[model samples]
Target: MSEGFNEASGSIIVRDLIQVIHEQRAYLSEIDGAIGDGDHGINMDKGFTLTARRMEGQLLGMSESLKLLGDILVEEIGGSMGPLYGTFFKKMARVSKGIGVVDGRVLEQMLESAYQGILTIGDARVGDKTMVDTLDPALQALKLANSAGRGFSDALDAMVEGAHAGWQSTKDMIARVGRASRLGERSRGTLDAGATSCYLIIKTLAQSMKELSK
Candidate 1:
C-alpha cells in the first residue's frame, strides 16, 4: 500500500479487518455493560464473525467484498446494532465503489461518509453522547492531520487519541439518546455505551489501516 486506506483493502488480507472487529468486540460490549443492555460485544462479534467468514467465501474482488459484507450485516445479524453497524460498513463500501484497494484518502472518505450515514439514520449530532460523539472528533482530527500531510500512522494515532477523549467525555454528558436516557439524572456518571464502543472500534480500525499503509 502507499500511505493510507486502500479500497482494495478487502481484496487484500480480507480477514484482518474482521480480526480487528473480533479483538474490539468484547471491549465495546464491556463498555456497554456499564450502562446499556450490555450486548454490544456479543452482537457486534456475531455480525462481524459472519461477515469475516462470508467475505472469505464470496470476496472475489473489491466491490464484491464490500457488497458481500453489506449483505451479511443486513441479512445475518440481529438486534438494533446489527442495522446500525451494518449500515456503517455498507456506507463505507460506497467510497470504494469500483476498485478493490482503498488507500489512505479513500479510507478517510469512507469513514467520513459512513459517519454521515450514521448521523442521518440516528439524527444524532455532536454532544448527543452517541457514536457521533466519538466519530466527529476523531474525523476532524484525521481531516486536520491529513491536510497537514501527516503520514497515515501519525494521523491514525491522533485519531485514536481523539476517540479516547471523546469516549471519556461522554461520562460527563447527560444522556440525550438511547435507553440510558431512561435513567435521567442517574445516567450522568456513566459513559455513553454506544459512544465508547464506537471509539474502540474506530480506534482499532485506524490502527489497522496504519499497518496497511505501511
Candidate 2:
C-alpha cells in the first residue's frame, strides 16, 4: 500500500513510466514461459518501446505522456493486450485530465477505469482467467476504501491484498478465453499467463511506490 499521493511534481516522470513499461515485458516473459506463449514479455516491451520512440521529447505533463502513450499502445502494439492495456492507460490518462499529480482516491479511479476497459474490450468476466482477475477486485476494493475515507496508504494496502487474491483465483479457472483456452481442461491447474503477468507488473508499480516513499 502506498501512502497519500505525494503532491510533489515528479511523483512519476515520463522516462520512468517508459522504463517501467519496458521492464514489464521482461517480467511478463518470465511468467508466461511457465505456461503460455512466453512472448507476453516481448510484446509489452515492444509496445512500450514504440511508445517511447513516438513520444520523443514531448512528454512534459502527466496527461501528455499518458495520452500519447495510449495512442501508441492501441495503434502500434500488436496483440489483444495492446488494445486492452491501451484502453486502460487511456482511461487513466483521462481520469488524470490535467492534474499534475493526484491523491490515492484518483489512483483508485484510474485503476477502475482500466478494469472497465478490459471488461468491455475483452468481453470476459470473472473466472475467465484474464488480466481482469488481477485488476477487477483491486479496483472494487479501492472504491470501497475510498468511500470509507480511509487514508491513501490504507486504501492502497487493501488494493494490494485484492490484487493478490485475484491473482490466486486464476489457478482454478479453466481458460475460457485467450489462446490458452484451446488447451481447455489442461489449463486448469496453471495460472493464467496474462493474469500472472498483470500481477507482477502491478506489484512492480506498488514496489516502485514503496521505494518512492523511502
TM-scores, each model vs. reference: 0.85, 0.84
The clash number for model 1 is 13
Q: What's each prediction's clash count? A: 13, 0
lDDT of each: 0.72, 0.72
lDDT for predicted candidate 1 compared with the true structure: 0.72
Look at candidate 2 and tell me the lDDT of residue 119. Answer: 81
Highest TM-score, which number? Answer: 1
lDDT of 2 by residue, 1-214 (tens): 3454343343254446568657666676766765678888788778777767766755355556666777877988858878987887788778877664466677877787878778888877888888888888777877888899886666767788888899999988887888877778888877776787677656655554555544
- What RMSD value applies to candidate 2? 2.9
| Sequence-dependent TM-score of model 2 | 0.84
lDDT of 1 by residue, 91-207 (tens): 876777875555556667877988888877776788866888888888888788888888777778887887888888888887777777677777788778678667767766765
Alpha carbon lDDT at 203, candidate 2: 65
Please give the distance, in angstroms, between residue 73's alpha carbon in candidate 1 and its true position after superposition: 2.3
